[model samples]
Target: MKKLFNNYINTFKGLSIEVWWLSLITFINRAGTMVIPFLTIYLNESLDFTFKEIGWIMPFWGLGSVVGTWLGGKLTDKIGYYKVMFTSLILTGVFFFLLQYVNTIIGFCTGIFLVMLVADTFRPAMFVALSAYSKPENKTRSVTLIRLAINLGFSAGPAIGGIIITSIGYFALFWIDGITCVLAAILLLQVLHPKKAKVLDTVKVENPVSVYKDKAFWVFFIAMFIFGFTFMQYFSTMPLYYKDARFLTEFEIGLLMGFNGFFIFLFEMPLTKWLENNVNSKIRLVTTGLFLIAISFIVLNFTNWIGILAIGILLMTIGEMIAFPFSNSFAIERGKKGNQGEYMAMYAISFSLANIFCHYFGMHMIDKYGFEFTWNAMTAFAFVGVFILLILLQILKREKAQQNL
Candidate 1:
């Protein structure tokens, strides 16, 4: 454990301004994300909104993420990360401040849409910043560090949000989130100062439409979309599953999620760097995570052992830590030089797509078919995804070997 801790420190021994600022900003944004777990409760209890109403309102988050991911990536390539991050932070804060006015379902949805649109934009700019500052060997470490900050924030933010909500009100949740966002924006503006680099002279001027025609990129798209399907299940369905089982209290749930965050903080950096060293092994881990996710649902359906369920959840978190960063790395590896934004944007689209499909189908499966059948169905999808990713990894390896030869 001590050796592992030292490895984590060594990963960031001499980080630059860009890396430090990006990690700090990400921590703030992720801490703000703590409001999410409580938001449903807030809507149902405090605001007197129904589940169906919240359901209708929630699409705004996915929709806004899609727009934010695309625009942030594009603008960063053209203008730069400084502008992109600053603009996203300011707009996100403004929308967060406006959450207080959302009385009707439509108004709430609109407000959320605006907030997500602004907030999600920061992602690509941050990724571009990481890729820019670090050498290829250490890029995974840098990305892992950013993820670590996010996890650390996630670990702390919810407990804090819960306390504030209990003492003050749900209104306090949004208020605190908004204030943190503004502070993050200000810090980002003040700290991040990248020395401008020369643009590629031979960069192609392909029409935006032409990017869609890249056959290889589309293969990546399909694989990642499968991963996204599983990803959204965590946020949308897991809470309901825990509720149905009657294993959760307000504070316990917060702690479980905080555990999730803590695991990411503990393991992501070392695991990511170790996996990057062995791409083939990393691909295998991705499949393992997916398989475990499916099995977790199967176990959840059959047993009432909360202890066992907790173990299953721990497995699922391991799978996530293995799979997600690799997917990001995979996308960057596949992009042609100078098209990082487009690739990153394309990578992000999978999450938006997953949010849509997972919510619709996952909810239906649980409502109509029962938990066992729904999870079994998701498991089948995971099997197919695993097969597809393996094929892609093989092709990537062969292509790389040929280039080296």
Candidate 2:
């Protein structure tokens, strides 16, 4: 047991202080992420929204995310990561406070859009900051550390959110979420103090348009898009499935969701480190992860038994542990020094696009067909992502060979 604990501790030893601070910031921010997880439920039960109406409204958040990521990437390169990160954090907190007052459908939809527009900017900037702060060799571990923080906080958020929703109301959830965002921003303000002009001058100025021209990146983008679309069902449709189809309570739903974070918190860091030491191929890791995710959904089709649900969630969490951090590392590796923000922004956009597609299509399927269909569709989508990734690996190899020649 002592040796086991030491091995886990050793995984975190050499990372920079900035990486630790960033992880702390992520923990703070994600701990208060109460709104989005429960947004569908809030709309359904509190506001009396139909599934169709909820579906239409949900995609607006994704649309805003799309805009936010694009603008954040540009601003990060121009203004420096510190400023972008600070501003995004503060503004997003303010927007979360504003979201509480939106009562009608249009008002709530617009509020969701605006809140996400500001909130989502933090993602790309965070990635850029992570890349800037860490050495090349520590990059994947750095990303994994941040993800570990996120999962730790995520484990708390939904459990607390379930309590707040049950005990106080939805309004309290907003207030708590907003306060935490502000607190996170304040912490960030204290930590990140880059010399703006010098930093900007030092950064390489890549043609932003060139990112779109890279065939390898485009292939990566497509794979990320599909992976994100399938994965996002956990946030978009799975909660509703638990409540509506399985007749679980909000607290029960929260527990189920929290299990994802709990499992990731326990295993992701160790798994990532082990993979780094043993697995030479990022493509293989990602392909295996995607298959695990597909199988997770397929597990759900077999049984709604609580034990089976836990197994499915565990599988998905393992998939996430293997896939996402490596994917971010792969993107960072693909880009030149100056283009990290641009590349990460594009990667972030894939998730934003997935949010739109997942909610729109996933919800529509649930409304028209059923949860079984939704899970099966997600399984098929992940398989497609795997196929694309395999092709992308080959293309990258060919490009590398040609460069050598």
Candidate 3:
């Protein structure tokens, strides 16, 4: 047992102090992420909107995420990640507070878009910062550490959001969300003592190839889009399924969602460390992850028992543990080969598009057909992602073989 503990501890040894600080900042920001997870529930219950209406409203966030990340990519290349991160942190916090006042369908459409626009700009810049702070050898583990922080915060946010909704009301969720975002920004500025020359890469890569010209990256974009489509149902429609099919309360749903984060926190880094040493093929790793997600969704279709929920979440969590860090590291490596900001922006945009498609499609399927049908549909989606990744693996191997000559 002591030897096992030391092995786990060794996974974290090489990361720099700045990487740790970046993880801390992400934790602070994400811990306050109370609004998005429960947005579907709030719209359905509080506003008395139909599932269709909730679906319509939710896609605006994806639209915003797309627009925000695109602009952030441009800004990061021009200004530096340090400034982009700081500005996004501050404005995103303010937008969360402002989003509370919106009530009508139009208001929500506009408000959610704006809030997500500011919020998601943090993603590519954050990725760039992760690469800048850590050594080349430690990049994947650094990504995992940051992800661990995100899941840790995710674990806390939903549980706390559920309690807030029950104890005070939904309105209070906006306040806490807004406060924490701003607090994260302040802490970022006041607490993190950054050396400007190291973290800020203001210099441009001259004659860089356009990301649109990269065939491998476009293939990756497709895989990530489908992955996002299949995986994100955990946030959008799955909660409604829990409420409708299993007769769970808001608190119960939150606990189940929190379980995803807690599970990832406990095991993702160690798993990544093991994989990096043992697995040479990242695309293969991603394909395996997608297969797990397909099973996760299909398992739900087979069993109506509540225990199936745990089983589904477990499978999905492991899939995510495998997929996300590797995908992130892939993007970082791909970007370094050409224009980092451009490649990373497209990476973020794939998920933005997925966010739009996933929520609307999941809600529509559930509303029109049933949970069982939606689960099967999500399973099919996951399998499609797996197919794409397999093709991607073949393309990467061919490209590597040509490069060797």
Best prediction by TM-score = 3
Candidate 1's residue-wise lDDT over 54-169, tens digit each? 88888888898898888887887788767888888877777777897788888888888888878878887777667776565565567677878877787778878878877988
Report the Cα lDDT for candidate 2: 0.84
What pairs collide in candidate 2? none
Which parts of model 2 have CA positions greater than 4 angstroms off? 40-53, 165-169, 195-209, 239-256, 299-310, 366-374
Expressed as tens digits, the lDDT of each residue in 198-295 for candidate 3 is 45323346788789899989999999999988888888788888899999998898789878877887788899999999997878888888899899
Of the candidates numbered 1 and 3, which has the greater lDDT value? 3
Q: After superposition, how far is residue 17 of candidate 1 from its true place, in Å?
A: 4.4
Model 3 Cα shift for residue 274 (angstroms): 0.5
**What TM-score quantifies how close candidate 3 is to the native fold?**
0.89
Question: Residues 1-405, candidate 2, lDDT per residue (tens digit)?
Answer: 999999989888778888888899999999998776799888899889998888678778878999999888878777867888899888988988888888788997899888888888888888888877887777889999998888788777887998998899999998999999999998887776674211211235554445777888888899889889888888868889888878889889878987887777777888888999999888779888889999989888886586887788888888988999899898877655346667778989998888777777887899999999889988998999999999988997898799899
Minimum summed lDDT over a 10-residue window in model 2 is located at 195-204
Among these predictions, the greatest lDDT belongs to: 3
Superpose all Cα atoms of candidate 3 onto the true structure and report the RMSD in Å to 1 decimal.
2.9
> Looking at candidate 2, what is the lDDT of residue 98?
85
